[model samples]
Target chain A: MSATNRQIRLAARPVGEVDPEDWEHCAGPVDEPGPGRFAGRTRAISLDPAMRGWLDDRPSYLPPVGIGEVMRAGSVIEVTASDHPDFQPGDHVVGTFGVQEYVVSDGRGAMKIDTSLAPPSTYLGALGMPGMTAYFGLLDVGALKDGETVVVSGAAGAVGTIAGQIAKAKGCRVVGIAGGPEKCAMLTDELGFDAAIDYRADDVRKALRRHAPDGIDVYFDNVGGDILDAALTRLAMHARVVVCGAISQYNNDTPVKGPSNYLSLLVRRARMEGFVVFDYADRYAQAARDIAAWIADGRIKVKEHIVQGSVDDFPETLQMLFRGENVGKLVLELV
Target chain B: MSATNRQIRLAARPVGEVDPEDWEHCAGPVDEPGPGRFAGRTRAISLDPAMRGWLDDRPSYLPPVGIGEVMRAGSVIEVTASDHPDFQPGDHVVGTFGVQEYVVSDGRGAMKIDTSLAPPSTYLGALGMPGMTAYFGLLDVGALKDGETVVVSGAAGAVGTIAGQIAKAKGCRVVGIAGGPEKCAMLTDELGFDAAIDYRADDVRKALRRHAPDGIDVYFDNVGGDILDAALTRLAMHARVVVCGAISQYNNDTPVKGPSNYLSLLVRRARMEGFVVFDYADRYAQAARDIAAWIADGRIKVKEHIVQGSVDDFPETLQMLFRGENVGKLVLELV
Candidate 1:
């Protein structure tokens, strides 16, 4: 075990695209587990689009990570030392463990994750918050019905990938909107998406109209702005737009574009609802059980783009999400 | 009865503010009632903010009124002749009778209104489409709850006036935002609103923060530009924004200013839902009955701005809606 813990801290709030200067890499003495406390070494870290929102100094589902603080993150940590009754050494846990080599917890928000069923990285992907976000955002907020035509933007990303697969598993026709040819191919060929539109190459509105010929009944929008506008224009009657995240507008220096075509809600008698996954904490266990079963049954496919480096690699790994370089669940595995 | 029908026809689509050239004053032979038809002389015509949306050539809840066609309107008509099974001569009815001195209808969307209960102008105002819009938009779309903080824009206008009163009737704390001091006074004093914000004088966001200190639960947005943005900023957890109309953007020569703060929906885990009253056509009867009871019980005050004029005055009367001159429901009464 390392005598010192290396941590990446927020140096400044990001403006438009996040810069390297916005983060600081520092090392501190590793804390010994005291009474009712547990210390863990981070094995895998989750890189999420929502992290960008947390960096902004504004009110959201969670308060922004203040400057000079260890950056807030969702990570799979292996308990190396423990004094807490509930958490034992050798047990793996998942929680808002900051971007650091080690984490100390009171076991408040941390949940012991079983790695025997799946790998540690899988806990950061399909069995984690992104998985739960896709689940509740689709089923609960969207009120998805069987045989409904579903469209998802940012379809190659973490939540989008799982959301599309879940829609397909539930007997819905799924059309995915992604960026490149590679990502689009991966969506259709590997992820079982019925159709995938490369948003970079095709006219999204036209492609959506062709793919979702019957009009979209459930639009799981992770990318807001123009794509959201396109989805709005093609909504079926009583469509439910699940606003999980808006990655497209997160890094914008200008104002986030509100969907001008929102009036489509009135025309189609539809609804648009935004949700936070933390709101569904009580049902996470059932959702995880269902997701695990689907994974075992081959109805869901898990994808991870793991960057191997120290905690210092986080800034670059996060940038991959905004650049649309990562294929699925982007993660940082400490080496 | 008049020998010729004096009609207002759509001459051209308005660019920004509606101009006199957008309408054509024409005279046509008054059609006699044929089989299963009724002919009626217009008693009072409804002038609505929604009329602005109908003039634009766009896909909305209803199709845009075509050039050279009689401008579509809702009016109270006194039946002069009838071969229709549902109607008889001397019966007063309400329907999409168009901007004309006389109308012949097959009773498709027409409902016979009793003037003994309320005046003809009231049917075009408080007891008509505007009334139904407030009822359903507030209760159904807004999903209003008692004790919730409700804020309404265009609070002195037709739908806004009725919506504020209905929210008050349902035991909600209501705050109204209107353009002028006179209109604002009407909202608080006559309409039973808890507070009123004169948007012209007060900084709307500051006023909203002052009035709804705890945060707003239901926001009934009628005038949708900056005021909508202000309301978005004050949304509480799980807020419901009822987008009944956007009169502020209806006449814009440029693109409509989509609320810049719409991301507030995501931050607050809220919803912004648009609704057209016509979509609730099946339930309008029940809603009307409830509204009538409220009016009879003095829980809801009816406000109407009646203009005594010919059908040709419609172009000028309609302008009153955009100018924010009328205090309540603006109607043109043919005397």
Candidate 2:
């Protein structure tokens, strides 16, 4: 076991795109697990677009990560010591364990994840919070019907990839909008998406008109901006726009562009709804079971882009999400 | 009957606030009703903020009022001649009869209204399209619950007045935001609202915090823009915002200012839904019945600002709505 813990702390609130100056590296003596607590080493840390929203000093689903504090993150940790009833040494757990080498927890929001069925990193990706977000956001918030037509933005990213695949699994026509030709090809060729539009190479509105000629019934929007406005123009009657995340706008110095064509909701009798994955805490286990079954049956493929690095690599790893550099789930695997 | 019918034709599309030149007063030969059709004399024409939206050349719930065409309007009329089975002379009816002294229709989308229950002008105000807009926009689109905190903007206008009363009747705590002290006072004292905020005099966000300290559960928005941003900031968990109209933005030559604080929707796990009243065509009868019962029981009050004038007075009468000069439902009663 390591004698010291290395951690990344928020040095300042990000103005627009996060800079290296916004983070600080720190070292501290490792503490033993106290009574009714467990100590664990982080094996993998999640790098999500949602993390950008947390860096802003504004009201959100979660409180902003305060300056000089350990940066808040979702990570898979392997228990090294335990003085709690629920946890034992060698058990793998998933929780909001900050960007650090070691963590001590009282088992408040932690759940033991089985590593035999899938690797520890899968718990931080498809089998974890992102997976739950895609499942509930599409099924409950989006109110997706079986034969509905779905269009997903940021379709090569974590939640989008899972959401599109799940829509396909439900017998819906799924169209994905990703940044590049390779990412777009991966969506149609590997992820079972019916059509994929390379947003970088084509005019998204015209491409959408070609691919979804009937109009989008369920729009799972992860990247908001002009693309959202285009999607608004092509909404079918009673369309459901699921506001998952706005990766495209999160790094903007200016205000987030509200969809100018949002009034389309009135013409189509449609609705746009926003939700947080934590709101579906009670349903996570059931969703996990279903997702696990799909993976076992080869219906839903698990996609991860794991970066082998130390805790100091988190800042650059996170920037990759905003740059549209990584595909599927992007995570940092502590070596 | 007069030798010619007096009519108002659209001379040009309004740039910002509508001008007198946008309308041209003309006299035309009154056509006789053909087989299965009816002819009627206009008694009262409804003046609405929605009319401003119809003048802009954009895709909306309804088509733009084309230049050189008879201006589209809703009016109460008395059947002067009929060959249709559903109507006869002396019957008062309500329909889209345009801005003309006389109308000929094929009995489609026209309803015979009983003046004995309410005045003929009431069919152009509280008991007509405005009433139906309030009914479904609140209960259905806003998903209003009995004990919820409801806040309404443009609280003294046609749909706003009706929507506030309906929310109050549903056992919800209602707060209204209006432009002037008189309109604000009418909301509380006459419309049975729990509180009223004078947006012209006081800061709306501060007033909303005072009135809805628990945050707004349902927001019935008519005058969108800054007020919509304020409402977004004060949303309670799982709140619903019904986007009925945006009278404030309809006259602007610049692009509409999208709400900068719309990310609040994600923070509160809330939704903002837009709806056009015409979509509930099948349920209008049921809604009208309930509204009539409420009016008879004294739970809902009828408020109308009637201008005694000829058809040529439409340009100025319509301007009254944009200037916020009219108290409740604005209508032109030809004298």
Candidate 3:
């Protein structure tokens, strides 16, 4: 085991796009598990669009990461030492373990994972927060019905891919909207999406009208902006717009652009609802079992873009999400 | 009865505000009731903000008023002649009778109203479509709970007055937003709203925060411009925004200013839903009963700005609604 741990701490509150100077990389003495605690080495860290929201000094589902504090993150860690009763040495756990090489926890909000079922990275990707987010955001908040047509924005991202697949598994026709032709092709060709719209190449509203000719019954929004407005214009009667995240607007210096065509909700008798995944913590195990079953049956495919790096690479890897550089679940795997 | 029926027809679709040139004042021969039909003399016409949306050629809850057609309006009429089974002379009825001095109907959408309980103009205001809109939009779409904090925009207008009072009747703390001080004062003093914000005089966001310090549980949005944005910022967790109308943006030549702070919905885990009151057609009777009981018990107050004029006055009276010139319900009563 390493005698020292490397960590990334927030140095400044970003104005718009997060800058390198905003993060401070430093080394510190590794924490030892005291009474009723366990220590672990982080194997993988999740890079999410929601991370951008946490960097701002504002109120949200979770409190902002304060300056001089380790950046808040969801990661998979392997236990190295333990004074806690439940956790043992070598057990893999998933939790909000922050952007660090080592962690000490009291088992509050930490869950032990079976590495034999899937790798540690898979837990951070398919069986972790993103998976639970797509599960409840679509099925619960979205109130999705079988055979309904669904349109997913940021379709190549973590939650979007899972949301689209869950819709397909329920016998619904799914259309994906992603930034590039390659991402669009991956959505349709590999992920079982009924159709894909390269937002960079197509007039999204017109494309949506053609692909979802009957109008989208459920729009799982991850990239909010003109794409959300496009989805609003093509909603069927009583459509459900699931407000999951707004990756496109996360780095904006100005205000988040609201959907101008949102009044279409009135004309179509539709609704737009926002939800946080943590609210469904009690049902995470059930959602995981269902997701696991789908993966085993070949109905759901796990997609992860693993970048091998140290904790210092987190700031750049996170920027990739806003720039739409990575596909599916973007993760940092420490060597 | 007069030898000719005076009518106001749509001349051209207005680009921004409806101009005098957009209306055609003409006279037509009064038609007799045909087989299985009825004829009536228009008693009072309801002026609504929704009329502007009907003038625009777009897909909406209802069809646009075609050029050269009688401008669509909801009015109360006194039955003068009938050939149908359910019709009789001297019975008062309400329906979408258009901006005309006389109306011929097959009794399709007509409802017989009791003038003994309320005046004919009151039927066009408090006991009519506006009343039902407030009832269903607040109780159903808003999912309002007793003792909750409720904020209403356009609170001195027809629907707003009723909505505010209904919220007050439910034992909720009601805050109203209107254009001028008089309208704001009317909301608090006469209509039973707990507080009022004059958007023209005060900083709306600051007023909302001060009035609804704990956060707004239900926001019944009737004017969806900056006021809607202001309400969005003050939402409590699990808030419901009922998009009843956007009178502020109805006549804008430019695109509607979308609520820039709408992402507050995500941060607060709230929802914004839109509904057409016509969808609750089957439940209007029940809703009207509740509203009527409240009014009778003095828990609700009826306010109307009645303009006594002929059919030629319809154009000017309708404009009073857009200018925020009238308080409570604005109605043109035919002499």
User: What C-alpha lDDT values do all the predictions have?
Assistant: 0.91, 0.91, 0.93
lDDT: worst 10-residue window of model 1 chain B: B255-264
Interface RMSD of each: 1.4, 1.4, 0.9
**Most accurate candidate by DockQ:** 3
B1-335 per-residue lDDT for model 2 (tens digits) = 55699999999988888989889899999999989999989999999999988888887778898988899999989999999999999999999999999999998889999999898778887789999999999999999999899999988999889999999899999999998989988888888999999889999999999999999999999987889889999999999988888888888888776766667877899998988898888998899899999999999999999999999999999988888999889999987
Q: lDDT of candidate 2 vs native?
A: 0.91
Query: What lDDT tens digits, residue by residue, belong to model 3 across residues B222-296?
Result: 999889998999999999999999999999999888888888888889999999989999998898888889889
Q: Considering only chain B, what TM-score does candidate 1 achieve?
A: 0.98
Q: Write the per-residue lDDT of candidate 1 for residues A124-156, one digit (tens) a residue.
A: 888998899999999999999999999999999
Docking class of 1: medium
Please tell me which model should have the higher lDDT, number 1 or number 3. 3
Off by over 4 Å in 3: none
Clashing pairs in 3: none
Alpha-carbon deviation at A53 in model 3, angstroms: 0.5
lDDT per residue for candidate 3 within A1-335, as digits (tens), equals 55788999999999999999999998989989999999999999999999999999987888999999999999999999999999999999999999999999999999999999998888987788899999999999999999999999999999989999999999999999999989998999999999999999999999999999999999999988999999999999999999999888998999889899989988998999999989999999999999999999999999999999999899999989988998989999999
Candidate 1's error at A309, in angstroms?
0.7
Q: Which of 2 and 3 is ahead in lDDT? A: 3
- Please give the ranking of all candidate structures by TM-score, highest first, separated by commas: 3, 1, 2
What's model 1's lDDT at B189?
83
Please compute and give the TM-score of the first chain of candidate 3 against the native first chain.
0.99
Error of 1 at A4 (Å): 1.4
